[model samples]
Target: MAAAAAMHISTEFINLKPNIWKKPDRASGSCCLGSDDISRKRKLPILLFDVMDTIVRDPFYHDVPAFFGMPMKELLECKHPMAWIEFEKGLIDEEELARKFFIDGRDFDLEGLKDCMRSGYSYLDGMQELLHTLAADDFEIHAFTNYPIWYNIIEDKLKLSAYLSWTFCSCISGKRKPDPDFYLEVVGHLGVEPCDCIFIDDRPTNVKCAIEIGMGGLCFQNAESLAKDLSHLGIDLSVPNI
Candidate 1:
């Protein structure tokens, strides 16, 4: 498994299969990460938790669309199509992201936008306790999410690094979720087989990718639902108030 070492987020790029979401045929094999290179040893499964809606709700999802003077649906449908993914992949900085997003003549305040992205993150009640309990039980946990440069704000504000062995973001890895390379790289870095991991993400698509790679996956509805799924997976989580 990957050590709980100093967080080293690299900019290196390694290409793998592209993730096309429409009707994906699940790969049937040992792993999307070649089994020949993987260790045959069985290992305890690590929990890979997603951020944003999975842990911290994104304020920008609604606020940014409103700031652009459009409804959320319209904004998502016609807004800067590739900017968010590009931003998440670290291809462009925040200023560039804002510039790209506000291209439709909407006035953009960089600081105000930063505030929208940074503040009022409400962690699902008992989430911290669940993480602590999992840690106490000697379960390995890591933060895996698709977030942009401002991910640092939420990471610091929520103090996630204190609980997780490693926190990986698209901005840091330059590889977004649902991409096979992202999951493969994480497993490769940890020196573990894909089967030795269970992923929790808010999106079904993200979970699907992990499943295709032979990792157990759970779509997170809430912390309570997560507790139930973990219990089903034979992980005894003792989180009160959940």
Candidate 2:
């Protein structure tokens, strides 16, 4: 009961089962297909992808709670003691993060806790082919993620930086998404207009925010829908010929 009460639904802790969005019905919130013009030219200018749930399967929301022998619904509540948003902003390190990974901080195994947090990540199905095809077609693929430094492990493990020419992560940028400044800075650094970029994330709020900024954005659900969305944008990605 305590755990259930603690895990109230909010934007801060997304990826809750049936859909990741706070407003799943309005996927790609208030979408304007300005980039559909590119389908005519059969060209893609740039691609910006979110890391969690977009590129990789999101395990953090579930695995951590399970580690503590609780239901996944209790993740946010369980994580309340942890300064996760600050961690995402690179304002704190793993040591600081690990310190907060407990409802009661007695006998906390820091190394073991760190290992649990770092391990057990996997890719979203069909993402490999999507990235492969886009990279093959010479898309200026980049990752615009709001994640902590620990995500570096995922990137290195999967060679994400190799697939995407650039990795614009929050830990590196010292900012988190939905802040709008993060978007402005990333686009400014790339020397591209927001409309020139295509951003993808599993969260509708993030997608909506991106669209509001004049970029072509898709609220990602799964790889199939993602492929279909790109297809509409003139970039058809089939199952990779690999």
Candidate 3:
């Protein structure tokens, strides 16, 4: 029954989807398609980057477990699975997450967790430089991520907006990746065909979903591999010598 309902939802979403490829006026604060408009002319893809683990280092796998004084295996076993997902979806608040974080409902230090996550929020190796190159070359970039409002913590720490707009966060958009609706929403909002965008993510599932929707996708293993993949698409990512 749940699967059938999800299918119905997906069907409705697709049926109602808008064509978002119209050119925008300059007043909307979007990067205008200027007189040269190569991104439009060549259909050079706007890069959509997944934030956690792709661009920013996610602490959940290492720091959080360490903070809890347990191995990742034990932390996964003890945690309430849906609590984190629900938090990412913006269906619950930090307070609710703290209350229900453990399967046994044991209270833990929420502030400490936040601190650990914050301390670990550095950009992954070479990702920052890659982003700078993309932005410098005027390839439009937007963060397409499934994270909660705590994304502000990352913003405050790393200033990622210097490279990509925090455009399609799940907390703001009410959708998570691997859900077709989320990818479709990005397409609809960007005023571009699915083919005009490429999504990069650390997770194969998320990349697959983007590809399934007719968007190009690259499974991001590391920054060097990513630059090579983008180069293969005929998008120039030649890093200028500093």
The model with the greatest TM-score is 3
TM-score per prediction, in order, is: 0.78, 0.77, 0.81
List the pairs of residues colliding in candidate 2: none
Which lDDT tens digits does candidate 1 get at residues 140-165? 78888887777778767888776785
Clashing pairs in 3: 20-191
Candidate 3, residues 84-160, lDDT tens digits: the string is 77888899999999998899999899999999999989988888888998898877899999898899999999999
lDDT of 2 by residue, 182-236 (tens): 8989778876566767888877667767877877788788888788777777676
Sort all candidates by lDDT, best to worst: 3, 1, 2
Q: How close is candidate 1 to the true structure, as a TM-score?
A: 0.78
TM match of model 3 to true structure: 0.81
What is the lDDT, from 0 to 100, of the residue 14 in candidate 3? 32
Off by more than 4 A, model 1: 1-43, 67-69
Residue 89, candidate 1: C-alpha displacement in angstroms: 0.3
Report the Cα RMSD per candidate.
10.1, 7.6, 8.2
Off by over 4 Å in 3: 1-43, 240-242
